[model samples]
Target: MSETVRIDSWLWATRFFKTRSLAKAAIEGGKVQIDGSKAKPSKNVQPGQTIAITKGTEHFEVIVEGLSSKRGPASVAQTLYQETEQSRSRREQSSEQRKLARAAAAAPDHKPSKKERRDIQRFKRDNLE
Candidate 1:
């Protein structure tokens, strides 16, 4: 017989989410789905199932490969599933984009001039109208 585990417990055990409660919350919030259908925290999960989880700006697509009832080390947790190639590529691309955006937004060594500050204030004030 194939092994099955609760969705929340599996998520927590695999380290896809930090805590079981958080995993439950995400499931309740509709941030986690199984086979393209929304699932409850108590839903049974088995190997060969596809799970999609959304957290903040990232979405993960994973295929369950194993089942575990206990949370374990990172290496052990990593064996629970395989991340989809598209998901991995998207995550890397998004990370690179965020890094570029952050670098662009960070002011080098120079402080804003008085005129620049006034312009910013004026722009904000104009937008508030």
Candidate 2:
């Protein structure tokens, strides 16, 4: 409801993180930036400010739209920021790449038996030698 909110609180309120501590960690870990520079958890976020956040393999760039110190529902949280078109496209591309990679590395239906494990180990040992 105020004109500005702390970055960590804003991130949590926007649902970018599950809790304020996580948001603070991300900010401190250099995973969150404002404009083009690193940001601290205490940074104040105002409308129209750009924020870049990296979470694991995903990246997001958003423009702040509203401010709220309290965590809200997804619908309300979404209204807090607008994701950049380029960021959305890049995120989708990366997501597709991850899906493809996962499909290619499909897990076996069953675990290897003792003999199979030994054979695999033996093959590796032979190759190493």
Candidate 3:
């Protein structure tokens, strides 16, 4: 609970990342930003500052509420930042879209015919060699 903490350390402590190394990698990869700009792992974060993070297909924007450099329980980690309403809604909408897309991409109701199956096997065999 020291006042001075690196952005990567805070990110790991707050449960945003499972490890400090992951947090640092994210920062270096430009997946994490502070106040709308890319942030370095060595940067210091304080209350009232905005942070944006991209992890896989999800995006999060949060305002810092407190600081902690030690990982803690989920409840305590949640208190370290407050997610914005817009960010929440956008995440939900994107998830819903992905669900719809996945549903539309469902496998065919019937299995391939014997000749079609042979073609599929041939394609795989040719490509996987």
Candidate 4:
């Protein structure tokens, strides 16, 4: 058998996605690329190749370091690739932003009355539309 594997399989086996279908969806959505080119779920992947994947505001650049046909523990899965420094920095920044957002949301100490709460809900619904 060939040492290379399907892109979707590799993504799942390496724990980039929760399932094969999700990995396929990411690939089809252009969120995953190989060597800077958008890749398909059926694309063949080999060891030592680089892949870029974007999830929300986070981008990951990983170089394939090993091959596996099965899903494994996080530690084992992590050994399959090496993430680039840029990717790490981006992840840290995204995390910090999320933390700040959470802190801001929880910072308000005043509790709203029932009427105030209803008005706030109405405002949110109106703004959403």
Per-structure clash totals for the candidates: 0, 0, 0, 0
Better of 3 and 4 by lDDT: 3
In candidate 2, stretches whose alpha carbon ends up further than 4 angstroms from where it belongs are none
lDDT tens readout by residue for model 4, 70-120: 999999999999999988998999899999999888756678999999999
The C-alpha TM-scores of every prediction are 0.86, 0.92, 0.85, 0.82
Cα lDDT tens digits, model 2, 17-100, are 998999999999999999999999889999999999999999999999999999868999999899999999999999999999
RMSD of each: 2.2, 1.9, 3.5, 3.3
The top-ranked prediction according to TM-score is 2
- Taking all chains together, the TM-score of candidate 3 against the true structure is 0.85
lDDT per prediction? Answer: 0.95, 0.95, 0.95, 0.92
Please give the range of 10 consecutive residues that has the lowest summed lDDT in model 2.
Answer: 1-10
